[model samples]
Target: MNASKFGAEYALSDDMAEFPAGHTGAFEVPYPRSCCCSSGDADLLEAARTMREALQEVWLVMDALGAYQSDDDRLSILHSPKFSSAAYRVRTAMIKTQRVAI
Candidate 1:
């Protein structure tokens, strides 16, 4: 949950739907997500679609975080408005901790 873990195999859980026949990421998959296909005709295109959608969602969330540091030398986060709630919270906490320690 904290960015260390990823991948289809890590997603298998009780909440996950039953995997399609021969599709085993770890155990269950609602449709098809596993790369391991014993089936003669594995329409990985379905899995690709799923992956694409998930990636798009991640792109939007990361973009909102202002996580990207552009290469342009002139652009500066220092002059930018606070970009995300997460950043703001962490910054505030760090400042408070420093003040308390002093």
Candidate 2:
């Protein structure tokens, strides 16, 4: 499943459809337009990308936990390569989003 599916409700909300062409629908947060040098679409895209990465980490962590067969297995899954990779993706995306020409 796509990571963004986790936030489908918010991402596909009616509020999104209400945004004007250039208005950064950064949702109700009122994140200043000056926060990014890029256009509204760019800001929204970057935010969506970051959200996807973060959700990926969440899913991976949950899956890892569910796959654990025993107490020892829990630690192994938590430190598993897949979980680590997903977490790294989230970390990088978060950093990228923060530095998105703000």
Candidate 3:
């Protein structure tokens, strides 16, 4: 996965700290335009919500994995029941999200 693609979602604001030295100007990130919700398209809204929840779950699991600093720690997490449960949910959510997206 491209880190830059995800970073595109983040925009530096006046409330945010200044960028480091040598930073130039800001460029507009390529954001996908949202669909019209007033059209009464329930399927689209459902798919969007599912995708968002799945992504959030994946993000949490990723943060948990980040706590493991060594191979042993990683192995322990790999064997954890919580890890397995999260993995299943993420996989299922991804499959559902993809189907609806198409």
Residue pairs clashing in model 2 are none
Error of 3 at 26 (Å): 38
Candidate 3's TM-score reads: 0.48
Q: Assess candidate 3 and give its lDDT.
A: 0.67
Q: lDDT for every model?
A: 0.47, 0.70, 0.67
A best-first ranking of the candidates according to their TM-score comes to 2, 3, 1
lDDT of 3 by residue, 1-102 (tens): 233955555555664456664453547688765866545566667777776776776676667678546778777877888677677877776776676533
Q: Put the candidates in lDDT order, highest first.
A: 2, 3, 1
True-vs-predicted CA distance for residue 50, candidate 3, Å: 1.8
Q: Residue by residue across 12-79, what tens digits does model 2's lDDT show?
A: 55766787767646556656776554565687687777879778777867776774378788888778
Model 1: residues >4 Å from true position, as ranges? Answer: 1-42, 67-102
**Cα miss at 55, model 3 (Å)?**
1.7
Write down the lDDT that model 1 would get: 0.47
lDDT of 1 by residue, 22-92 (tens): 55445553887565654532444444444455555545545744745564422443334432433454455
TM-score of each: 0.26, 0.48, 0.48
Please say which candidate is ahead in lDDT: 2 or 3.
2
- Model 1 Cα RMSD, Å? 21.5
Alpha-carbon error at 7 in model 2, in Å? 52
Clashes of each: 1, 0, 0
Candidate that would win on lDDT: 2
Q: List the pairs of residues colliding in candidate 3.
A: none
